[model samples]
Every structure is written in C-alpha cells, then in structure tokens.
Target: DQQVKQNSPSLSVQEGRISILNCDYTNSMFDYFLWYKKYPAEGPTFLISISSIKDKNEDGRFTVFLNKSAKHLSLHIVPSQPGDSAVYFCAASDWGYQKVTFGTGTKLQVIP
Candidate 1:
C-alpha cells in the first residue's frame, strides 16, 4: 500500500521559533520526496524537495531531511513567523511516476 503518514494533525509554536513536522512512509520504492505548503482556500505550493540519492535539502528558512534507510523524513522551519502558519504536506513518488502520494497534512499554528 502507498501510505504516507503525518501522525500529528496539528502543531503550535510561538513566533520566531523553530517548527518541525514529521512524516513516515511504508513504500520502499519511492525515489523522490517533496514538501508542500498550503494556505487556507489555496492549492498546495511546492516548498522543497530531495532526491532518494540525497539526504538533505534546504532553502532559506526551510529545510528537509530524508532518511532513506528509515523511510522517514522531516521538515524544519527556522524562526517561524506568524505568517508561516499553514498546512504542510509531505509527498513521495517513484522515479518517472507523475502521481504523488501526499500525507494527510500538518497544520502549523504560529502564535504572534
């Protein structure tokens, strides 16, 4: 089965602090990973991605780490701001497969 799990449905953090979201997958054939950030009433937007060949990828305030051996991944946001509150989704896909399996989602609440 292709099941990507985001165990925590919600998380809260104060402004200017770090926020972390976790995800786990059961499928071992997945070769590429991606993270998306979605705001209310809008489609998910690509944030960062990592290849199965790489362990970590970072973009400015956001960082994603993939552990292929453990079949786990995490997204880290440094000094999260109030504007950063939104739902985050972890997605995975096999090489050459356009279809991506997404985690349920994790809502991040940033306190002002």
Candidate 2:
C-alpha cells in the first residue's frame, strides 16, 4: 500500500509566479515530511523539510507546510524560476525509524 501520494503527476507554473505542490499521506506514524528535487540523470537532493511539531518551515524561496490533522503537506516556491524545474518527491518518515516512504513525484515545469 502506498502511504504517500502526489495526486498530480505534473504541474506547470510561469516564471516569477508561485508554485504549489501537494502531498497526502495515510500513515499516522510519520513524524517528518521532506521534499526532494531530482534532475535528469542525477540523484534526488534534499530540498526542504518540516517536522510534525511545526506547521511550517521556510528556507529562502522554499517553504514546506505540514497539516497533521489532514495528513497532508505542501511545498511552496515563490518567484518560481526555470532552474527550479524538476521532479519533486514528497517523503515521510517516523522519528528514529530511519525508513522513509516516498511519493511517485510531481514533475514541475517552470516556464519562462
């Protein structure tokens, strides 16, 4: 059973606009939410993350929000640029579990 899911397979956003990526999880044991960005022929790199204790976390242009009650999370990128285009994966894990479940991913295209 897939615990994490990204309903949208792809998303398109214009350059300089805001990009929103959504994720949903069914596992209540998950306590950490993470976002990873992957480019062609490259490994997925950690982008941003949010702990279950907090509702939101921001780093520069990237922000992640966790809604525990809704079992959902979202990543927001403001002033989206072409370079930001990538396949974003939403991952979740429980504290000390050292195991993470990832969503299939959402391909984001930032059009210039």
Candidate 3:
C-alpha cells in the first residue's frame, strides 16, 4: 500500500497564477511533513516543511497546509512563474524514523 499519494500526476498554471498541488497519507504515525521541488535529474530540494503540531507554514511564494485529521496536505504557489515549472514531491516521516515516504510526484507547468 502506498503510504503517500498525489492524486494528480500533473498540473498546469499560467504565470502569476496560483498553483496548487495535493497529497494524502495513510499512516497516522507520520509527524513531520515536507515538500520538495525537483528539476530534471537532480535530487529533490526541500521547499517547505511543517510539524504535525502546526496546520500551516509559508515561505515566500510557497505555502503548505496540513490537515492531520484528514491525512491531507497541499502546496500552494502564488504568482507562479515559468521557472516554477517542475516536479513537486510530498514526503512524510515519523519521529526517529530515518526513512521518508514520498508521493509519486506532481509535475507543475507554469506557462509564461
């Protein structure tokens, strides 16, 4: 069973528009959540993260909201730019667990 899931495989948004990506997790043990943006072959870079104790976290153009009760999370990018086009992965981890469960990933296309 997939511990994490990104329902949409891809998403397209116009530049300066809002781009939203969704993810879901099945495990209640997960406490730490993270969002990573990847370009091509490079490894995923951490974008934003939030502990289960909080419901929302934001950084510049990116914002992540977590709903523990629903086991869902979302990443929102405001004023999306062409450079924002890339793949986004949602990951979850339990305290003291070295391994992180990652979603399949959502490819975001920000059209200029």
Candidate 4:
C-alpha cells in the first residue's frame, strides 16, 4: 500500500490567486513532510517542509501545514504565477527511517 496519497490529480488557478494542494498519509511514523515542485524534463525541486512538531511552516509565498492527528498535510501558494505551473509532490519521512515516500503528485496550472 502507498504511504502517501494525493487525491487531486490537478488544479487550476488564476494568476495572482491562491492555489491549494492536499496530501494524506497513513503512517504515523512520519515525522517530516516536504513538498516538491517538478517541471517537465526535470527532477522535483524541494519547496518547503514541516516537522511533526510544527503545525505550519512558511517561506515567502509558499506555506506548508501539517495535521498529525489527521495524517494530512497541505500546501498553499499565494499570488499564483504562470511560472509556478508544475507537478507538485508531497513527501514524508520518518525520523528513524531512511526511505522517503512520495505522493502521486498534483499538476497545477496558473492561468493567465
């Protein structure tokens, strides 16, 4: 079974608006969560992350929120830009575990 899952396959948002992406995990052992953005012909680029101890972490226009009890996490992008269009992946890793599980990914498009 997959440890992490992204129910939404894609998302569309107007430029200068907010884009929200969601992810869910079944493993409670996961202590760290990360969001990666991938462009075509390129590998995923690490965006932001949150620790289990923190409910929210923000970096500039990107923010990631984690809900431990709900086994869920979400990413918020404010003032979405056309350049931000890409496939977003959610990843989770346990404190003592070496393997990081990634979600299926959600393709986001920022319409001009």
Candidate 5:
C-alpha cells in the first residue's frame, strides 16, 4: 500500500501559465508535508513545506496547500518558467516516526 501517491505521472504547461500538481496520502499520522523538485542527475531539492498546523504555505512562485481531513495536498506554480520544469515529489513524515515517505514523482514540462 502506498503511503503517499501522486495520481498524475506527467504534466505540461505553457510558460507564464499556472501549473498544478496533486498528491494524496493514506496515513493520517503524517505531521509534516514537503515538496521537492529534482532534475536529471541531481538530488532532489526541497521546494516548500507545511506543518500539520498550517493549511497553506507560499514562497515566491510556488505555493503548497494541504487539506488534512482529505489527506490531500497540491503544489501550484504561477507563471511557470521553462527552468521550473522538473520532477516533483511529495513527502510526508510523522514527527515521532523515523520514516519519511515519498510519493511517486510527477514530471512537469514548462513549454516556452
């Protein structure tokens, strides 16, 4: 069983458009949710994060929203740029647990 899931395998968006990526999780014990972006041959880089106490977090062009009751979250990029294209992963962890689970990544292509 998947503790974290990203239903969409890929997404394409035009430059300057909005891109939305979805994620769902089965574990309610998860207290911290994070998003990471990875490029080929490179390690994943942390993008944004939200603690269970918050519903939303935003930084510049990236925004992450969490709906705890539904065990769902989404990452949104406004005016996406070509350089923003990457594989995005959703991760979750419980503060008391040693394991951090990651969802299957969603490949994003921002067409210029």
Candidate 6:
C-alpha cells in the first residue's frame, strides 16, 4: 500500500501566479514533511520542509504546510516562474525511524 499519494499527476499554471501542490498520507506516525523538486535527468533537490510541531514553514517563495489531523500537506509557490517548473515530490518520515515515504511526483509546468 502506498502511504503517500499525490492525486494530481500534473499541474499547470501561468507565470507570476500562485501554484499549489497537494499530498495525502495514510501514516500518522510521520513527523516530518519534505518537498523536493526534480528536473529532467537530474536528482531531486530538497526544496522546503515542515515539522509536525509547526503547521507551516516558508523559505523564499516556497511554503510548506502540514495538517496532522488530516494527514495532509501542501506546498505553495507564489509568483510561480518557469524556472520553478519541475516534478515535485512530497515525502514524509518519522525523525526517529529515518525511513522516508515519497509520493509519486506531480509535474508542474509554468507557462511564461
């Protein structure tokens, strides 16, 4: 069973608009949430993260939110740009366990 899921396989947005990516998880034990961005033929790079203790974390134009009660999390990118286009993966893990579960990435395309 897939513990983490990104229902939307792809998303498209215009440049300078806000883009929202959603993720859901079945595991309640997850204490840390991470978002990664991957470009063609390259490894995924860590983007933003949030801990269970906090509902939100922001870095630059990227923000991550965790809803423990709903086992859901989302990443928001404001004024999305073409360079921000990539396959975004939502990952979750229990800090102590050190094992991470990743959702099938959602491909985001920004139109300039």
TM-score of each: 0.96, 0.99, 0.97, 0.98, 0.97, 0.98
Candidate 3's C-alpha runs over 4 A off are none
lDDT (tens digit, per residue) of candidate 6 on 1-112: 9999999999999999999999999988899989999999999999998889999999999999888999999999998999999999999999999898999999999999
After superposition, the stretches of candidate 6 with alpha carbons farther than 4 Å from their true spots are: none
Candidate 2: count the clashes.
0
Q: Where does candidate 3 clash, by residue pair?
A: none
Q: What is the C-alpha RMSD of each candidate to the true structure, in Å?
A: 1.0, 0.4, 0.7, 0.7, 0.8, 0.5
Candidate 1, 3-73: lDDT as tens digits: 89999999999999999999999998889999999999999999999999999999999999999889999
Q: Compute the lDDT for candidate 2.
A: 0.97
36 Cα displacement, candidate 2 (Å): 0.1
lDDT, candidate 4, residue 105? 100
Which of the numbered candidates is closest to the native, going by highest lDDT?
2
Provide the lowest-lDDT 10-residue window in model 6.
63-72
**lDDT (CA) for every model shown?**
0.94, 0.97, 0.95, 0.96, 0.96, 0.95
lDDT of 5 at 103: 97
Worst 10 residues of 5 by lDDT: 95-104
Instruction: List model 3 lDDT by residue over 1-112, tens digit each.
Output: 9999999999999999999999999999999999999999899999999999999999999999999999999999998999999999999999687579999999999998
**Number of backbone collisions per candidate:** 0, 0, 0, 0, 0, 0
Among all windows of 10 consecutive residues in model 4, the one with the lowest summed lDDT is 93-102
What does candidate 4 score in Cα RMSD to the true structure?
0.7
Tell how far residue 35 is off in model 6, in angstroms: 0.2
Q: Over all chains combined, what TM-score does candidate 2 have?
A: 0.99
lDDT score of residue 28 within candidate 3: 97
Better of 2 and 4 by TM-score: 2
